[model samples]
Structure formats: structure tokens, C-alpha cells
Target chain A: MQKISPLRSSIEAFNKFKAARLNKADKAQKTNQQSQTNPFGITFKGTVIQMDVFEKAEKVNENTQKAISLKEKMQNTGKLLASAWVGTINKFSSLKTNAIAFGNKIKDSTIAAAKKIRDFGNTKVEFDVFKYNVSRLQNKPVSELRTMLSNELQGVTNE
Target chain B: MNNKRVKNIIEALGKHKDEESIEVLNELGTNCPIDEIREMTSKALIRKNTHRALELMIVNKGKGINDLSARVAMCAINELLALKDKQEAIKILDDTINMHSEKEVQDTARSVKALMSFSS
Candidate 1:
């Protein structure tokens, strides 16, 4: 006896539902064609479908693909932000030798990058997670900040 | 992932100081990889104003990710501040104006600060 995985079962169920719905739509189209009749004994008639079914199906499939891509991106939100943060920090440290000469420019660029990171967190992170993160951040020491982000990055990547 | 308990604790924190409870909830919300639970807790924190709800809204106002929630939270924060502790709210907005480089965020802070000033 073989055991099926829950994820596999859920996917199977979704595919079955989708197939059944599509079949019903095809059957309905056929039924509509069969129900068409001519009045006054005029028997010469043909059914003309306006919108292409295949096109509609392709459109639906495209939307589904887009949705799947969005989900994948959402899952990577933590990692993306984490990498950005690390990159910004490294850039700053490497430029420390020229700090006096490029002070204003460095500061401005760093602030801009930081703003982008915050924007990413605020937008991409779910609201509850955002709130929780804000509160959690208040309690943490500055030294431990990277640990938190790294953990988030790991969790997202691991999944 | 006990969402019900998290909700209850957040409600309690709104009324009284529960440092440990808030800390635990914050940890759960931060550490949980599950999207749905984190979302529920985020909403809970916003409604209670336990976290940096207003600050988050101010920073994220222009970005399209969670506009509706941010708008609603901004309104709620405005009302709450308008009723009490207006100075702190004004200071927060002022900091946002001075510190943030994003034009959208600065504009949002300026408008909200003006509205608060007018209302008060």
C-alpha cells in the first residue's frame, strides 16, 4: 500500500476541481449550441462563438501563473531585504577610508538605501508581521539586529 | 501559533502594561513563517497601538503594498492622538518630516501634521 502526501492530495483535489469546472463550461457551451433553433421552418443555421474559449482559458492560466510568481516573491521578501541590508553595511564599511571626502554623499546614499529597505519591509511584509517586527525591534539591542534579520532570511529561504 | 491567545493578550495589553506578554507576542509574530498567523497578529497590534503602528503607516503610506491597512491605521492613530497625547504624535510626524528622504513619506507626514495641528 502506498501513502499519499497531504500536499499532493491538496494539489490533486484542486486540479480535479479545476478540470470539472472546465468540463462543465465545455458541456454548457455544447448545450447552448444544441438548444439553438430557427423559427418559421428555416433549418439553415450555424452557431458562431464570439469569444474564443481557448483564449479565455489561456488568460486564466496566465493569471494563475502570475499568482504563483507573486507567492514565490512574497516568500523571498525576508531574504531580499536581508541581503540588501548586508550589502549596504558592507558598502559603508568599505568606504570608511574616504569617509571625510564622501561624507555627505555616503550619508545620503545610505539613507536612501535604508529608506528602500524600510519601504520593502513596510510594503512586502504582512501587516501583522510588520507590527510584530516593529514591536520586537523596540525590545532588542542594536548589536543583535542582524541576527533577527538573518533568522527571517533563513526561515523564508528554508521554506 | 495560538492566534486566539495572541488576540486576547494584545487586547489585555491595550488596557495594561504586560511587557512579557507583549514581548512573547512580538516574538511569535516575528518568528512565525506562516503568513496567516503573522497577518492576524499584525492587525491585532495595529488595532491596539501596541507596536509602532503609526510610524509604520507614516513610512509606508505611499508604497502600494498595504495601503488600505496603512490608511485605516493612520486614521485610527490620528483620532487616538487627537483625543490624547497630541504632542507626541506631532513630534513623531515632525521627525518623519526631518528624517525621511522619500518625498511621499515627507508629504504624508506634513499633511498629517497639518491636519493634527488644525484639529487640535
Candidate 2:
């Protein structure tokens, strides 16, 4: 009994067209589902069959085992490398300590030798030798002095 | 001979007052091929401070201030300048300037005399 507006009529027509298109799309989807092909090229109708279920599970288990083994191998190789590096560092440190100890030993021996020589030089024998040489030089004749001086001069010149 | 032995001998000769010591110094110290020996000899002669020693330094060529080696010559000049009693040195220098046959020796003597007078 009410007057139909132009905008309402157009919206009603659009709704009807949309309902028909949805019904057609639903029918097409059902038809596609009835004859859908799986990724393995096997066609099935209506309900999906659980094909190759045990085989897929076995393949997945195999891949998981391979990954775990690879991870364990990488971890073992890293542990071995770390141990080798630590051993090398220990060896180098030992060598360094040995070198320092050897150097200290050489220094101590050298100092001891020098002290011994100094002690020997401080003895009365050294003084007596020096006195003897001086007295001998004082008593020497002029000709002898000349000859000694000439020899020393010639020696210095040669040097 | 070792350098220490040579040094000991030079020191012994320097302390000796015998005329033969002077002869040795003049012959070996002054005429040596080594400049160090010449320098040591000049110092030894100056230590003697005798008239003959002064004469050797002032009158001789290639010895003392007249030495070819400038280091030896300067050492001799310094020893002369350091003398507590320069009267003998001045007298010898004057004699060298007046009576020395070499003109170079006379000039060296004159220059040394001027330096001595200035230092005094």
C-alpha cells in the first residue's frame, strides 16, 4: 500500500542479483569440491581420503633425524675446536714462562761470575803484582825505557 | 802492549825527573804516529814544568801548539794556559819568537804569548 522509492527499488534489485551470484558461486564450489585434484595428481570426490599418511610421517621423521644429527655434529666440531684452541694457549703460556725462567737463570749466573772476578781482583796477590810491576819500571835503565816506550808507541800506531 | 800498560809507562815517565825521561818523551811522545800519544806526551811534558819541557812545547814543530793535529795542539795550549807558574812558559815562548829558525814557530809563539798575556 506504500509508495516505493527509486533508491529502494534499485537496492532491492542489487540484493537480488547478489543473492543469485552467491548461489551460483556456492554451486560451483561444491562441483569443484566433488572433483578436486590433490598436489600428488590424485582426484577425489566429496570427502578427502587420508592417502600416504604413514609414508609422509616416515619422511618427516627421517628429515627430523637428519637435522638432529647435523646439529649434534656441528656442536661436537665446535667443542673440539674450542679444546684445541685452549690447549694451544696453554702451550704458548708454558713456553713463555720457560723463556723467562731461562733468562733469569742466565742473568743470575752472569752476575755471580762477575762478583767472583771482582773478589779475585781484591786479593793481595793482585796488589803484589801491581807493586812488582811499578818497582820494576822504576829501576829500569834509560835504554830499556826507550825501547819499551818505542814498542808501546809502535803498538799503538799499528792498532 | 795493552793500552793500560802503555798508559802506565807514560805516567811513570812523566813522574821521572831524569834527563833521559825528557829524551824519551821528546822522541816517543812527540814524534809518535798516533795523535793521542802526542797529546799524552805534551801533557806529560807540561807536568814536568821544567825549562827544557817548556822549550820543547814552544819551539818544536808538530809538537804541542805547533802540532799538525789541532786536538793535540789545543791540548798542549790548554795545559800551558792552566799552568800555576807561567813564567817559564812565557820565557820559552819569547825565546821561540825571537830565536827560532822557523817563521811558523815564531808566529805560533807570538800568538801563544798574546793569549797568555790576555789570560793573565
Which structure among the candidates has the greatest DockQ? 2
Q: For residue A15, what is the lDDT in candidate 1?
A: 100
| RMSD list, candidates in order | 39.6, 14.4
Ten contiguous residues minimizing lDDT sum, candidate 2 chain A: A35-44
**TM-scores, in order shown?**
0.30, 0.51
Residues A51-134, candidate 1: write the lDDT tens digits: 332255534578888999899998799789999999999999878856766888889999999999998878855455544444
- Per residue, candidate 2 scores C-alpha lDDT tens digits across A11-130 of 999999999999999997876675454334344584454445425554557888999999999999999999999999999999999999999999999999999999988975645347
- Tell me the docking grade of candidate 2: acceptable
Q: Put down candidate 1 lDDT per residue, B29-52, tens digits, no spaces.
A: 434555543444444444444335
Which 10 consecutive residues of model 1 chain B have the lowest summed lDDT? B62-71
Computed on C-alphas against the true complex, the DockQ of each candidate is 0.01, 0.28
